[model samples]
Target: MLQHLKDHSNHEALQLQLFASTGEGITLYELESGKETFPFYLTKGTYYIRIFSNDQPMKYSFTSSFSKGDNFENELNNTKSTAKLMIPNTTFTGTLNDGGYDNQFADVDVYKFEL
Candidate 1:
């Protein structure tokens, strides 16, 4: 597919990553300021997203076509032991940062709900 990439940061380099609940990860896309962007796919079942930006003060907007995301996620919930407790139907949002200097990137974040 062919599409124009949006440059909210003067074409600063950017990356959009995808991770499956099973911990499967594959680089789906990189949308730079002035290039064409190809759409990526996400097969069903709990997914995680990580956005990396070369732009220091990166600014972007994300909207889901379907109501499948929460509005808040607590940080450091990157492991099973650190899993964040989730309340049913409540909105939660979180950010996954770049594997800066140490490359100690938290590849996945999990949330749990107790019955």
Candidate 2:
């Protein structure tokens, strides 16, 4: 049977809470390895996450953060290779700099801590 909710789900909130585990590590929901849905938690404030990868077959590292201001880059990497991120509290505009470009394409995965 299916369950019903009291109100429509928040799209942005749901995205922030998504995660994927790849045995080695965890990653965002959209980047998960397998076709299974993983669970994560989300709060009404700032959050940070880091992604690590194996080097034997590949090499890369990923670190990303989300907050409620224009200083998004301050919480993340200061390099060229980066990923697209949305600042959680201020209208969801702008991109965050996630360190390590190669990491994004590696076999690395992601996990959520506090959700």
Candidate 3:
């Protein structure tokens, strides 16, 4: 599963959008700011997503039955535990997992937005 966050300090309504590689592409989960959990179907491939908002210190998390890729060969490098991928003008905290496999990995995150 893939997770994304916005700048928590922005004080704006943020939308979390995610796509599963095995099931859908548009968005498997969509939620407003401060939502704890969002359920979505996961495919057996790479996935993509897009997050919108302008808040700093945002947080996110996800769960799926997919697997991680060889890229995570280094256990320490892999963010198995809850990770907070901080973005410019934003702070993000979330949990990402591959469900214990080596065939799926969601979008780690490209460019965070500020709107």
Candidate 4:
């Protein structure tokens, strides 16, 4: 299961996309507004997750695989400028620049881990 939270109540809704590892370039699931994806069985392989806010210019991506008993959690702020991904025994925090094309802030940050 995947879960998310925002700092503000009136923030733009969040978007999520899931992809398989078959390299077929197809999306497995797409969701919005913090809704949880329905429980589905998955094979043992790599999977991709993409997250972003409806009105923000930044996007975040992650990769994971199915395990015996694993839980995942993701947290983001309303501005879509900060995020945290948590898994068993590991946590990754990311921050992005609000400047879309102006380069006012540094580029977005991404962290990858294997479990």
TM-score of each: 0.40, 0.19, 0.30, 0.33
lDDT of 1 at 7: 50
lDDT of 4 by residue, 14-76 (tens): 555445676432233343434364343344567665566666653333334444532332222
How many Å off is the CA of 32 in candidate 3? Answer: 3.9
lDDT of 2 by residue, 11-115 (tens): 121121222242232234322231233332332444444432221232222333434444322212233333324434443232321222336543322211222
Q: What's the best-to-worst order under TM-score?
A: 1, 4, 3, 2
Q: Which ten residues in a row have the lowest lDDT in candidate 2?
A: 11-20
Give the lowest summed-lDDT range of ten residues in model 1: 35-44
Q: Candidates ranked by lDDT, best first?
A: 1, 3, 4, 2
Give the residue spans of candidate 1 off by over 4 A. Answer: 1-11, 34-40, 66-115
Task: Please write out the lDDT profile of model 1 over residues 6-104, one tens digit for every residue.
Answer: 556456666666676877564445666544533333334587777777666665555445434444554456788898788887866554544532344
Each prediction's whole-model lDDT (CA):
0.57, 0.29, 0.43, 0.43
Residue 64 accuracy (lDDT) in model 1: 46
* Cα RMSD for predicted model 2: 17.4
State the lDDT of candidate 3 residue by residue for 4-102, as single tens digits: 554444365545555556544333233454445544334245666555555655566655464433222121224435332334654333334433234
Question: What local lDDT score does residue 45 receive in model 2, on the 0 to 100 scale?
Answer: 40
Best by TM-score: 1
lDDT of candidate 4 vs native?
A: 0.43
